[model samples]
Target: MRTVDQKLRDRRRRHILTAAISCFIRDGFHRASMQEICKEAGMSPGNLYRYFDSKEAIIEAIAEDERKENATYYAKLFRAKNFLKSLGKMLGASLKKASDPNYERIALEVAAEASRNPKVAAMFAQNEAETKASLVLALRDAAARGEIDGQLDFEAVATILIAVADGAIGRMSLDPALRTTALMPTMKIMITRFLRPPDGP
Candidate 1:
């Protein structure tokens, strides 16, 4: 149980994080300043500092929120009765989210930065591991239910699926003009091959 004061503080902290994410999405992480974030959050510098020690802390908060959201999505996916249908929906949802220009810009930029910054890289690695675990669970369930071949390696297959999805999103970010018709067929072929059973119909 949380006290009212504690709840209020949590709410304010979430608000500040939301504002910071919006600012970071609109302006690259390197360009977005604490002052701008404070202004967007409707909090003074002192108040913002009460919630986050620094801009880096705010960025981490934003990244953590995204990680949690992805986890929740995977949870829902695991709960789905028809694994194939759920997988399709999950891929569609991810593609739609990635299509958002703001999300694309910030996510791609942060990922690149993480490659160069030890702190950011550590955070990203932690998030990636958690996400991979969730994926492995989902893939295992799918295999148990016969949606995927039982003999295949769940963790490795999950890794490949995640990599393909990430690559699709990255490619879309690079060339928004490419028709989904052109790319989705390639994806469908790969997925169909993976999901196909050994025995003939």
Candidate 2:
């Protein structure tokens, strides 16, 4: 099922992506060039080009990888016994992940760059739409089970939830002292109260 050639290709691809991320974090996505990525990866331009010819390609790859990772989390949510609590924990984890400076800087810069690049803008928009769809599905399912309030529009709730998480990320990005541990308890309380069933909980 495995071949040395395929393994080597995967390793090279990972190496290139890692180097690209470092270049983006250090010099920024807008300023980081292919040559810088090649230098960072310790590979010739030709060699690196074979794996990924453009920074946009690397960003697309990163988006795809994150999409797969988020899919796993959404899948796990379906099996969670305490839906609202699990949802709170997932949001807390997301906030912590998104608050990392290295991640935030690169992600924000990429978002900025995407505004000027149609290809990247389309790719990013699709990724955001897919994530929102997954969230709406999960929220609707929770409501159907009578865990969350079924009266509220799942689409609007998902949008607000994502916006809240994004706001936390932006605020924490500016103020590193706003620790996740401190914010999470209040967030958890807010989530539980917002989604909890009236007669059941």
Candidate 3:
């Protein structure tokens, strides 16, 4: 159970994170300032610094939170026995959010910064590795359930699926036009192909 002070601190931290993400999206990481972040968060500069020592710290926290959320999202599918059902639910959840124009715009900005910022890049890489490990474990479960054959290379296949999903989301975030046709279909095909049982091999 959290005390009132702890809850308030958590709320403030959340506000700071949301403000930092908005500022980073609007101004890019290099240009976003602590002063601007404070204004966006509706807190004084002194107060903001109490929550986060610097803009980089805030960005790191955001990345860590995003990574944790990603892991948690996939953990649900890993727990499920119904392969196609879990796949569809996951795809639908992702597509619904990514399809939103505002979310897509912010995600694109984050991706651009991720390419140049060493910390952000490393964080994303670590996040990807964790996600892939979770996926491989899930695939192994699917294989054991007879939904997928055991002979298939689970790690390799999980890597390919992760790559495909990342590629689709990255492309969609950059070009909204692609979402209309290729994005969802590519995702569907990947899930279908990956889950399909081997033809007596």
Q: Which numbered prediction scores highest in lDDT against the true structure?
A: 2
Winning model by TM-score: 2
State each model's CA lDDT, in order.
Answer: 0.79, 0.86, 0.76
Q: Write the per-residue lDDT of candidate 2 for residues 1-201, one digit (tens) a residue.
A: 469889999988988888899999998898999999999999999898898878888999988888888888888888898788888888988888987888888788889889889998888788888888999999888889899888888888888888888888888878988887889989888888877777767
The lDDT-based order of candidates, best leading, equals: 2, 1, 3
Better of 1 and 3 by lDDT: 1
Q: In angstroms, what RMSD does candidate 2 have relative to the true structure?
A: 1.4
Query: On a 0 to 1 TM-score scale, where does candidate 3 land against the true structure?
Result: 0.84
**Comparing 2 and 3 on TM-score, the stronger one:** 2
What TM-scores do the predictions have? 0.84, 0.94, 0.84
lDDT for each residue of candidate 3 in 13-82, tens digit (9 for 90 to 100): 9989988878877887778889998889888987888989986688678778878887777889878878
Candidate 1 per-residue lDDT over residues 14-97, each given as its tens digit: 999779878877887778899999999988999889889887797788778879898888988889986666776677677767
lDDT of 2: 0.86
Residue 26 lDDT, candidate 2, scale 0-100? 91
Which parts of model 3 are misplaced by more than 4 Å? 174-186
